[model samples]
Target: MIKKSIVFAAFDEEYVATIEFKLAKLTEERASIEFITDAGCLEAFLERPKKIDVLILPYGIMLPHPEAFSKTSIYYLTEEEMDAENPAYIYKYYSVKRMLEKIDSGLITEAESEKGTKVVGVFSASGGTGKTITALTLAHKLMKKGKRVIYISTVPYQDFTYYIDDASVLGTAFCYQCSINIKNALKIIQDEIKNEGFDFLPSFKNLPVSYQMKFSVYSQIVDYLRDKNIYDYIVVELSSELEADKLVFLKNCDWKVLLTTQDKIAVGKLEALLSNMLDFDRNILILCNRYKYNQPDFLSGAQLLQKYEFSEFIEEYNAPLDLEMTKNSQLFDRTILCME
Candidate 1:
């Protein structure tokens, strides 16, 4: 969706910080707010008559030239009084819920909807099932089909970086620092795209385990990319061990692909995981990697359906050790084309 441009004029430092914190909780990509702390800066901005969808002014702030913003939608942030006639006033210390309600209710001008970006997540219950290969090949295939695609590895230790040779990996630390500002994050991503041939956000290998578990930061980075509407598709590679926060991130995705092998242990673990995750049944697709048609199955398809409540098993693809060979083959044809 296109982001609405909002200009907030508040001189108080404490108030500005509170508003910033409130704004960070907003989930929709409807508005992009610009905060002005100095009164002079606000006045100067008003004098120039910038193209802004919403102009938020502090209660009782004197406007030297109110006529200049005649075309702009003006709202007052007041706590003591709310004008009955002009109901465009919001409480200065309103909760984030109320603020979001106001924005969704058309009291605040809404952002236009642009072309939506699709997010696909690839996950597994255990490691070494070719999850990274599936994600990377899907991205390469989508890009080859003339679609803008970015591959993000959210796995711990970021083993996926070794597959993409000669690319400068943007560690999780850099992402956490820059994630506060969407524009700054976009600049970094653009610079990386320019230097590297492909679009990717590398793993956070250098970060401590505690820092790496900040799933909100990871979600913000993905949301920034989606809101920017820069790519047609985003393929996310997740860690095998799915925590509560990781499940929260997976629930936000448009599609979720679960990769598992025919090993009895892997299938057993997957069955246990699926029993607890009944909500994702509709959007989740179970992919059995490295299946041989002639070989007897350790975990049969019927058993998977009966045990895990899966609708059906997706077609299996041969596992190729050579990354280049896999990309050139039809390994990702069914998955990528089906998504489109």
Candidate 2:
């Protein structure tokens, strides 16, 4: 007898969940179920799984950049073929059920080969800078502006929660309630966005420093998002302090922003940081966070723009930084996010 398998390409979150629920109802049966959200997970899963039986694909998965469908048994379910009322879209629900039955009866063996996902990493170069704030702010802004955004911060101290305080937190408790785990955090983010349209995920929590995260894990998360077209923007925040893992993540970001100030030491450090990114297609945009013009000689924003050729990218105007908030609050509620 041929081994049995199940494959699905879920486009939006609702459809993914609907399929998952239907698959769950079949738990009493002996067949094993392997669900894939996007091409990233599909490729990653295919690399490790012993065998594959049924392949279900999201219609939009291969549409963005047609190269995605090169060698996969999966086929498209065009909009005309899909029906909202029918679980299998445009086709009759039982037709899909019968197709699965055929697979279980030693009909289909393996799918044609296909591609993987793309990723965008975000990192910064110094301490006491606004790396986390910038990541959170940009992700939040994108989401509010109607784009799907997945905000992630690899810093273990957990600052993302505060930046998106208005939204319900997806913390340990929430994950437990939903039966989710950190290893699947990226998948969960995909699921949330697929269903809810946008979401955020904190870095792996409660880990001892003895085992720092490998860059591979970060890459996997980035690939998952890219493969699924899960979000319009993927904003990542690394610790302001440098580390091996930090460098790994920075190299992966499509555009790297170096947050800095006019302080002599900070400026010197930033110059050195730029020297390191010489070969990458990364932009070293300078973010002047919590700035104030206290001295007569201090350049106005425009003058700074001319002095610093890259200053044109300065994102927003904000009140001076409050040293107190930086040191005392768990929320790290900066004046910018709090702005009405």
Question: TM-score: which candidate is best?
Answer: 1
- Model 1 pairs in collision: none
lDDT of 1 by residue, 114-138 (tens): 3689889998998877888888877
In TM-score terms, candidate 1 sits at 0.57
Each prediction's TM-score versus the true structure: 0.57, 0.46
lDDT string, candidate 2, 220-272, tens digits: 66667767775666767666666765676677665455566555556567666
Which segments of candidate 2 are over 4 A away from where they belong? 1-122, 166-198, 203-212, 295-340
Stretch of 10 with least lDDT, candidate 1: 306-315
lDDT of each: 0.67, 0.47
Root-mean-square deviation of Cα positions for candidate 2 versus the true structure, in angstroms: 19.1
